[model samples]
Target: MNNHSRRRFLSDVGKGMLVAGIGSNLAMELGISNALANDDANALTFGSLEPLVDLMQQIPVEKLQPALVHEIQRGTELKTLVAAGALANARHFAGHDYVGFHTMMALMPAWRIAEELPQTEQPLPVLKVLYRNTARIQEAGGDERLHTAEPAKLADTRRGGERLLKDMYKGDMQSAERTFAALSQGERSNAYNDLQHLVQDAPDVHRVTLAWRAWDTLQLLGYEHAHTLLRQSVRYCVEREQERLKKDRPEPALRKLTPRLLDDYKLLSKKTGLRKTDDAWVEQLAQTFFAATREQAAEAAAEALAEGFAPEDIGEAMSLAANLLILHDPGRPEKWASPEKPKDSVHGASVGVHASDSANSWRNIARVTNQRNLVCSLLVGAWHTAGQTGYITDSPFAFDVDVITSKKLDADALLAELNTAVQAKNQSKAMAVVKSWEIAGNPAKPIFDCLRRYAVSEDGALHAEKYFRTVTEEFTTTRPEFRWRHLIGLARVSASEYGWPAPGRDQARDLLET
Candidate 1:
């Protein structure tokens, strides 16, 4: 544990990252693969080794409560406006929807990463090389080739892949149903095992748990929307799994390295009573997603562990999360909102509650603004408390950085167009402007203008306020997609500022009528 060894360890990491640098044109592989941590005696661990666990990894591990608290205070706005309110209302604004949950879902994890490493040796240089390298491959269209790749990275055989999404999006319901039905439970189970292993072993569990804890924090504060939370929170897991799969490792190697137990499952079980449990964690997670009393969600998670739900249960949960991810890839966050076409519905039904089946079919009602990012602070907190961060996050490049180097967006003009769309109650149009915004390079000023003008909740307002003004201004060469997503939500909230609801069943169908 001397400086000499630490220096060597970091140097080795740098070498691997350099090999995987942006110039290599290979999709980046995340995790501490082939790193010296395996050899090092003093490997750094995240969360706590004992009872006073970071739990949500929010305050203790991530020191994220301030950020969450800050976001809640700054972003909230009333229908009619007067800047943000004087004081914050965490409970009032927490469950504003998936957008807020998603914002934190992404934000908290990044913060946790920053918190994990030693502040003295800023690791951005190392992470930059790896992220840039991986992004190069993705940008070059290599990562998506698993279906056609030489090794065929991971198998999607019976479960399904993006093809199912295309079918659904293209209104091929018959084909979609056949594909969904064709998924033999056996194949699904197998795939789940692989995915579960991925979840238990993936390096990004730190980030995923960070996001999960963020969900619980939101729910505990009062933001709960069950189906929406489950649907979206799963995306974080998908994000991690995708990042892992992009490395194009073979199945056998993955299985070999993948931990059979995330840790001493028995020890974890005894500590938190979460051993050999069932879908209790699912329900525990649901209480928060559904926005139950903090007490209810806490009790549920505790009870699940008391019943013996261990990481295997988490593996099953990851399987479901992976399926949801395939159903909706994390890479294409933009697709979350395609113009809702009535014919897209199979039987004029919506997959979730309160969704209008006026068109009479199973439809993809998911939108970026779905606002169900179930921070899972409680659920994740339980796991984080029971076990370690379950991640060897000693590397600098924990995630792909979307460096902010693009053309500038005209804050005033974009706002004008965005305002017009919102005032017009044109959901599609407003969405278009948000997505189509050539919002790049020094766009923070304009981004903030939108935040102040139309922030959906205090959380969104706060996050946007600080990020645009501070993070973008301070950091360089990072993925601005998170910002883009945030801005998109701001636009949606702005558009809905005057009570313009997301066009309901019959109303949405009427779009074709016009």
Candidate 2:
């Protein structure tokens, strides 16, 4: 073989290789087109996809494409094409002359083919393709791009409307409110109309979004607007699933709606026409509301009590009732008084009498000792309620005679001793003393009298005043009382150089004046 013959053979081989490559490329292109065509032929089409196009137009440029992608992936196959076609229209209508409409148009058919194929056989390998792209579009602020109108015209008002709805769904209440406010009346109406359409088509989704919007609107627009939104939401829930109006729906929206509905009923009950003479209806509403949500009903009941009863009386009654309940319970803080010491029994006899006929001359003194201790206990217990500073035992005389005489102690010392005895669980002594004190007479009388004496005395007077003042301050801040002693103390201190004698004297005075 010569050089010319070898060259000719190599050239022939090169041509063969080029022809094979061209053939392969042509086949691949044709296959892609065929697959797209087949998918388009089988794909569902819903009217010019104009509505979706219109919606996409409202989204911002950066968000527009990604959101379209998201809707396409998540929506029905037909819906996806509509979304894609709409996106293409949005791009073209925005007038970027460099990119052919066909290039924008091509994605619909490709997505359609992807939709038609089994999900496992779909190209681009992962679900992230849809999700990642959608998120990117959102992050890029694609929703804002939708606000642009055509070259000469403002964008479709509905575009802004949908954005508002989306903002509401996102819990961006401030933006939603601002957008709604910025819209002209006509635009606002159109937005709501669009919302109505969306909601009518997908009631479940609408319910969730509407409930959220209602709550946000309530925060932004005050109770009136919030109430209106709440009513609409309640109606929607009731219309969609009447069972929701019943007690069983655990959907937070539905649950929340029930309370709102009850509130509406209560409001209605205040009307002159229906509620003025209709006791049964009012009762029924009250019962239903209470049965539905006891906590709300209780709050309402409390408000009613405030309106119907004197505030002071109602408050005192509630406190007293609650305290009584606790007092009755053995485990409560105020249960038993301190115990007494054990003592021998005592027989009836004069103190100076001799033991003449001796069987056993002396008898146990338990009864007498217990009686005396009981008086002391009662005095101490009652002392707790004296003029916001001292105890007020059930009986003043019993404390003076049984507790004071037997123990040879003053009121303040008795109070300290009582506290110690109670803390030590000396219940028998505590109860005995308490009983004896109650039998003595107004038990708190002594405590107040003792406070008065201390307040006036020179020696230990300042110490007494400080103690009383501290105790009174604590009481005023916590369990304040308005008794004659407190009033008297106030009067006495009013003219003195020293400021109010008690710790919270100013507060106590204010309370008394009120």
Candidate 3:
């Protein structure tokens, strides 16, 4: 391409005209049609994402790894590869399918893992997730049809998030998409904050995590494609609501409970308190949430907020309540551990994983949303977490660490012990080790290093990577008083998911090498 044509191509990309699903004819008109390299080049690809999206959709599962390896060797950006994966995922699943959206939830974390890894090993997470994405795409018959299209503009600009959520509640997909598309063009936070209102209306882990991940991948995909990325959340909400209506299931009690708690506590109009609490206070709050009914838990959180507790404190207590689910989980029943879903144990798709992921997502949502939504999200989280307590095991995991013989072990020794416990799948010992390390006032890095190894390599039934990311993030953002609880939560999960290797690590390593 000459300088003039290069300038034209870049200019078109700047104007967002290189959108793949809708711009093939436009590419031909611009005489840069070769960029759409594959014969089946139709999906919502954009700018640098075009050819990779084409390859991901059209390449056979057996052949895609080498093709991706070729793309990377030829100077393709990892962000672009991840961007294409997101677009491919959005095009194919659009947050509608179960496995489909789980794949979507893992995309950003895969990129994060790749970013932090050694250069030679960097491609493992990306390749593994892409392999999963394409395999699912092929299973759905290798179609190029998009579940999400270019959204139409809302005719009335006066409509906003509340109206958009109302549209979803009514199961109106077109109006929801249009409202969200127009909203996406405005301040990005406002659009995301609006979406949290709907996301917290249900206790579904996939809904909350998908909403957070869709907004998160924007760091790679950029806000120019915000409409494309965010519309998935809108569509997800609509589909879930539609499914609920189809089954004649009653609306989630949170729909009414959240607002009632918000108004009753005057939380919508008030700024949250900056009050901090001690460990005893946190333990008391967590136990209250653990044992209370959903309505009672929401009221407790609202009461705490009204009486001037910091939002993060309330979120911390809520996270602990969710962690309690993991701590008390009954091991997977033998009948449920079949070859088809072999990882159907307490570490993966259990109620604990669901609760933990949902609470982690709620914490993330709380950070970005408005004060009103923050309050509502916390209340809803408290309610949602309280609901999960019904699944707690008959015998809760022991909290007292009898195995730790020394009180002053250095960080490395503590980590080595913790790692031993994790490898052995000794949940009690792992929990005790981390708790002892925390009590010794050691730095967190060694513990992080210890857990990250398992998180990187373990299958975790697909939850390990995302859950690791979740705890790492939540630990950083949470208050110092309450953060170690997240690490303990991580140890519990890591120990539970210790033995199984990730699905394609060896294959990804070989493909990257040769």
Candidate 4:
């Protein structure tokens, strides 16, 4: 074994091993590529390619043909080619291009495509190719056309479904349901399941998606299914978020709940519950929520109300909802009514027009009147409780009455007195006097005379007339036993004094006869 011979032998062995290794590596690489090609070929088509092609063929050539031409002119990159392949498979076959030709070749059965490839190296270039081809096809109005359910449209739908699923997983069911509804059933199912996994791991997300799905399903299915779904979702949310729910515990739970507070909570619960039951419940709940929480529920309820919910129902729902909300945190301060006006304005005792000299009582009456203005309905209810509309009637001013009187005075004397008051422009005094006389239960002659004589001068006369008309109508309709002899008498005098024609005097005559 000479040195030269040993070196040559070593070199030869190294060369042979290197060559063998290279051959093995190439074989493995080729084998892997073939397997990948095979897998790619078998990848899901969702549906037949011909249908997509047919649909694409139907798309206006002007709209889709141009894009295909542009892509062909541009030639295909891998992304563009993949896009083209997808387009071709989806039946968007416009015409041949180097990229599409290569893509089809790569996807050919003899190519032995793979099931999946690393995303970074995946043939997204095919997408660009497809885009260009589709563009040309769309522009030229070639064989390939766009349709409502084109591959591109379906791809977009799929993308939207993915986004919706993500949102649902994050506990945005409303959005998810919306996205789901826009998708085909297969896409919807995929999104729904994705959301389910998210819900299981992240309960908040689950709760939200469940509620949204339930609500959406209800729209599709009906009440029973929807309610069941809602209940299930709510239960899941409530249970899963039990720790969060604990935040609602009142600091001092032992305090006796005020009737008002209890009422508020009851109202809130009722409103929220009603929303789950009635289609229009959302509107009412929103109103109640807003009323209770100073418009917190406004956004939620706005859509429902805009769709046309009844105002009264909304009001009641808001009241109920507010009550429920208050129960969860009863430490809220009470809202007080505004302060009352000074008593002198109301009792008229300061004007010396009334016989009642009870100063403190008059002041109280004024205070009550001021309160009445602030809360008319509440005050009215309270008055009704007191079993007397006459509480207002018996007063020297007769809060409800609007007239003037003067006993032992002729019509001329009454007119003169009224005229003097009018001339002096003592409108307040005139009204006060009129109201006093009416309160005193005087006959209509003096009251009507005073009004007619001075009405031209006194601004209060307008208010007086309205009151007179209201009272006259009420008395005429309600008190059948009391023939409106006073009204008739006053009408006759009014005609005489005002110098109006008596063409309708027959009506007055009939009233008198009655």
Find the number of clashing residue pairs for candidate 4.
Answer: 67
Model 1 alpha-carbon drift over 4 Å, by segment: 1-411, 438-442, 456-478, 500-514
- Considering TM-score, where higher is better, how would the candidates rank from best to worst? 3, 1, 2, 4
- Write one digit per residue (lDDT tens) for candidate 3, span 375-432: 8788888888885655666577675665585555677677778888999988778889
- CA error at residue 206 for candidate 3, angstroms: 1.0
Worst 10 residues of 3 by lDDT: 34-43
Off by over 4 Å in 4: 1-408, 425-442, 452-514
Backbone clash tally (model 2): 51
Best by TM-score: 3
Q: In model 2, which regions exceed 4 Å deviation? A: 1-307, 332-413, 427-514
RMSD (Cα, Å) of model 2? 33.9
RMSD of 1: 25.3
Clashes of each: 51, 51, 0, 67
Clashes of 3: 0
Q: Write the per-residue lDDT of candidate 1 for residues 112-214, one digit (tens) a residue.
A: 3323334421122112211222222223331111110011222455334344434333344344333433332233333222222222222232333322333
lDDT of 2 by residue, 306-396 (tens): 2332222322222222122111222212332212111210111101000100000000111112222212111111111111101111221
Candidate 4: tens digits of C-alpha lDDT, residues 415-508: 5655554445343444344444444555655555454432111112012122223224323322222223223222221221232211222222
Among these predictions, the greatest lDDT belongs to 3
The whole-model C-alpha lDDT of candidate 4 against the native structure comes to 0.29
